[model samples]
Target: MKHVPAMQSLTPAVDARYQTLLRKLITKNGIGGKDSTAFVDDAKKQKLKTDESSIPLPVFEKGIHVNQAPPTSSNGLNGNSPTDDSTSDLSKTVSSTQDDRANDVKDEIMRNVLTIPMLKYDDLKAATDNWSDANLLGRGGFGQVFKGVWLNSLVAIKRLRDTDARNRELIRELCLNQYRHDNILPLYGYSFGGAEACLVYQFMACGSLEQKLRSKSHYPPLTWSQRYRIAHGVARGLQYLHTMTGTPLIHGDIKPANILLDQCLMPKIGDFGLARKGPYGEERTHLKVSRVHGTRPYLPDEYLRSRCLSPAVDVFSYGVVMVEIASCLPPIDRNRPVPLLSDWIQQQARDGLDFASLEDRLLQGTPHSNPGLCREFVAIGVHCTKYSRGDRPTMLEVYKRLDNLEFPGKHYM
Candidate 1:
């Protein structure tokens, strides 16, 4: 067994930002003569009268970048709001002080997100044939994806729709470590191409799980063995994110489309723009977002009511993905009223439909000639999507259970 050091941030530039903001706040409040802690306490007592964000503070919230509303904390203690309890001047000032300190921590983080060769716009343009339609892979809400070559290596580059106000915070959060996993996609580097911002990542030759599931010819529906490996790999990737060396990170968006496959049919989870940190120095295991994002079927019942997110949410999404992987079904089929595969499958089970009936038509063998293993794989999926968060298993548990299920009886890295 071996260990690699987790990445650490280096933000000397941000270290001095707090003192500057602290002095500014002191001067603005005319509290230079008073003790800082005492002044803060007195200010907390005063009620806020306005709901305006007139103050420009360098506050950072997970998944929020430029032009996004600050996240509203579950307890209403963090985030910015347009109401009395949320937007009071005292609260704003106090929150800003904390934000400034956190910003320094974030600065060092963004600096080391990815360390690799930089790619200029010219390089990307040349590789992508000047962003030609021929190189275009697909277009989505975030931006357009293209297949290109740089330094003799193929790469997938995302050209964001809004260069100025998108995903910068995510890039920094990702900087906390270099991702090297059998399942997670590798982020090469990002670039500012004059009027646009683009992110570069290793090219997955086989496209996405959604594409393959939708059309079997999208390079052959994966074999039962491949599906088993993909399932375990995706689980391992989720576990890595949840219990990695650093703070727990919730993938926030987990779906088949977000799961890209390499030439060998290995799945790598991508699209982290909606990612979030679970908690900070608190007993809570979840955090609220500015708003709910991600596919509805994959979202848990609580998230539909409130935007609160935790590792369980990721597990829920993973379950949906696992269902699709096993049954070759979409997470949501609009043709059905319930739409969610979990709901649909559960209904079938209620009617006494057995495990053999649940396998995807394209899959071969008894999931490596072991019917119990096949049932267990799908059973784990069902357990992961339990309505109550407490009932759902942790990703580590899910991964271990699947790992023990066996995959062609070979040792995996």
Candidate 2:
């Protein structure tokens, strides 16, 4: 059989590793044996199924924006409490149907993961001290992460909750192993069956960008320079996802919580649970979804209204994250004069407030703070958050603008 060409633009070592992986995959597909020439053509045509059942496409009630929206009635309207036994029985039936669907998706994921390297469930459990609370790293919509030691190396083990979201994340993360970059979080391995489904990832000593932004003394405050680098790193990672991959991928969720930082504060984008592959070829600009599924303030107007997704959706979310980094404020805080931080920032900027007046209070008087750089940075974010999808800059443009920002003696770029 003919060999697949090694991917271009990768280092020799990375390309060699990819070739090794390709050969192993060919063998696993039963295409490495003699008389396997015919099988190669068929394998090349195989692609991931993108249907609702196969892709974990979420089904949300008509007006729901967030994943944790309140329950709606049978007729798809907000209804008062049911006062009859029949209503209770109906709820049970709906729950059963959801459970069956979740199991089917989980089964498909368990089968797909067979091709990857796996760790023993018991060994992972032991590494985390039987999943003790003390070892907990953080929690997300899909699972709880714990810090652990595996093969004498520090790792983060994520024990997923038994739900459709978990299945979706598991499959997406599996796909990430093939598209490695310096800014993307690396997957070490996975463990499944027995008691829980777990994915092991390279440990981030500095935790998530969200944690650092919201820190109230548990961790040191992030200097202006660190925030600048964090934004640049995240932009590079998102740009890679959009244009570098063979098929452009949209990281549907790009909140600060998904961006992790290493000990030196180098940022790596993580959590592909909500990621979706964008349409292929230049003619196709967007992918239509059954319903909108993402966090608020980060989602763009077009995505929410039309359910049409493109790389711009990710760009919009990244813009919101930029605002977060500059302001050191949560995306949504009901107590604030403006509940949505992105909107508030835009309003304040439009009101002609200087960067010094708009920046995080803690950043004021700090030696690293530079009003000129901060203004330029916030302007980039505002440009990305434009109401019109066509108006926002591509991630590449965003990266270039960030790269041009003056940060003296910074070598990471």
> 266-368, model 2: which lDDT tens digit per residue?
9999888777766566556665454466787788866766566789999989988987788777888899888886677778778887755557777678775
Q: Per-residue lDDT of 1-413 in model 1, one digit per residue for the tens?
A: 00001110111112333233443455575653656545445444544321111111122233322232332443232333334443353344544545544555444343453354445767887889999999999987768999999889999988876532244333433452454676778878666544566778889998988888888764665666777778888999999988874467777779888999998888898877666556543345555443466677788876655445678999998988887777777787899877878788777666776665567766545344445555766787888888888899999999998877754554543
Off by over 4 Å in 1: 1-97, 113-116, 167-177, 280-282, 364-371, 407-413
Candidate 1 TM-score over all chains jointly: 0.74
Which ten residues in a row are the worst by lDDT in model 2? Answer: 6-15
Q: Give lDDT for model 2.
A: 0.69
Count of backbone collisions in candidate 1: 1
lDDT of 1 at 341: 85
Best candidate according to TM-score: 1
